[model samples]
Target: MEKFKITDLDLYYGTFKALIKVNLTIEANQITAFIGPSGCGKSTLLKSLNRMNDLIEGCRIDGNVLLDGEDIYGNIDVNLLRKRVGMVFQKPNPFPMSIYDNVAYGPRTHGIHSKIKLDEIVETSLRNAAIWDELKDRLKKSALGISGGQQQRLCIARALAVQPEVLLMDEPTSALDPISTSKIEDLISELKERYTIIIVTHNMQQAVRISDKTAFFLLGQVIEYDTTENIFSNPRQKETEDYITGRFG
Candidate 1:
């Protein structure tokens, strides 16, 4: 099933075109990676999925972005759409509060008042993010005290607590150590069973390692998109082949 359908998406910041007309269908409950060099519109396209670009000054979009067959950009509540599609940034940005509070923040803001219910949601989200086992006893500790990787997991837990159907990540492990990066990669594999994931990553190896489908972008356009195996092994586009083979990017 297609969870998202983007058709002829063209984005602009003032007069500069950041993305050209692009069409793609993101499969439900799968990991889709947007791989490209810096400034190729990979991040811009990812932000469009959840309308994150709306926050940027002078940004404009021309096209249709359908979520579950509904046009999200047409008279829809931005807040509600965001709840259905959560986002994690390139950096781990946990709140300067207790770990429990950090995880519970979203549900609380959305009017989950009962302490018992909030507790359960927190635990479930943390477990889903693969951080509960390590931080169960330290739930009251400040999130800032945790390691960078743990902080990122906590951020993931916070996003999950909102019960989003689609999760968007932008270079989620870029700043982490090797071991931490591996853990997050493993978590991405586990997450695809339940939530649709769209990630923008510069790391070709990571994209090849964790994604079910890979999309290659160049000069603000989608050059190719296909199964991970096909993309890495036998891409039909010479540009994709060159990018993947370290010939040029």
Candidate 2:
């Protein structure tokens, strides 16, 4: 099942064209990776999925981005669209509150006000993100006090609390150490069974390790997209081979 279908997509920031004629289909309950060097429109296309680009002044897009067969750019409510498509940023951005409150924030935003209901959502989301066992005793402690890796998992739990169908992650493990990065990689593996995940990563190994499909982008265009094994071992494009082999990014 396709969770998102993007066709003839073009995106611009002010006068600069950031993406051009992009087309792709993202499958449900699987991990898809976008890999490229800096400023190659990988993040640009990711932001367009849920209209995060709408917040930028003079940002414009031309094309169709469909979520579950409905055009997200149409008359849909932006808030509701966001609820269905949650995002975790490059950095861990937990609220400066208790761990429990951090996980409960999204449900609260959607009018889930009961304390009992919030508690259940908090616990379930934390467990789903594979962080409940580590943080259960510290639920009342400040989220800012945790380790960087734990904080990232907390952010994931927070996103999960909204009951999102898709998770958009932009270099989620970039700032973490090797051990922390490994934990996140494991969590992503577990997460794909329930939620469709789209990630932008500069780490080729990480993409190979976690993603089922890989899309290689260059100069604002997707040069190749295919299964992760095929992309890593036998890409059709010379540019892809060069990039993956460390000849150049």
- Alpha-carbon runs more than 4 Å astray in model 1: none
Candidate 1: 10-residue stretch with minimal lDDT: 240-249
What local lDDT score does residue 226 receive in model 1, on the 0 to 100 scale?
Answer: 99
lDDT of 2 by residue, 1-249 (tens): 999999999999999999989999999999999998899999999999999999999999999999999999999999999999999999999999999999998898899999999999999999999999999999999999999999999999999999999999999999999999999999999999999999999999999999999999998899999999999999999999999999974
Task: Give the runs in model 2 whose Cα sits over 4 Å from its true position.
Answer: none
- TM-scores for all predictions: 0.98, 0.99
Which residue pairs come into collision in candidate 1?
Answer: none
Q: Residue 218 lDDT in model 2?
A: 90
Tens-digit lDDT string for candidate 1 (1-249): 999999999999999999999899999999999998889999999999889999999999999999999998999999889999999989999999999999899999899989999999999999999999999999999999999999999999999999999999999999999999999999989998989999988898999899999999998999999999999999999999999998974
For model 2, where is the 10-residue window of minimal lDDT? 240-249
lDDT at residue 235 of model 1 (Cα atoms): 98
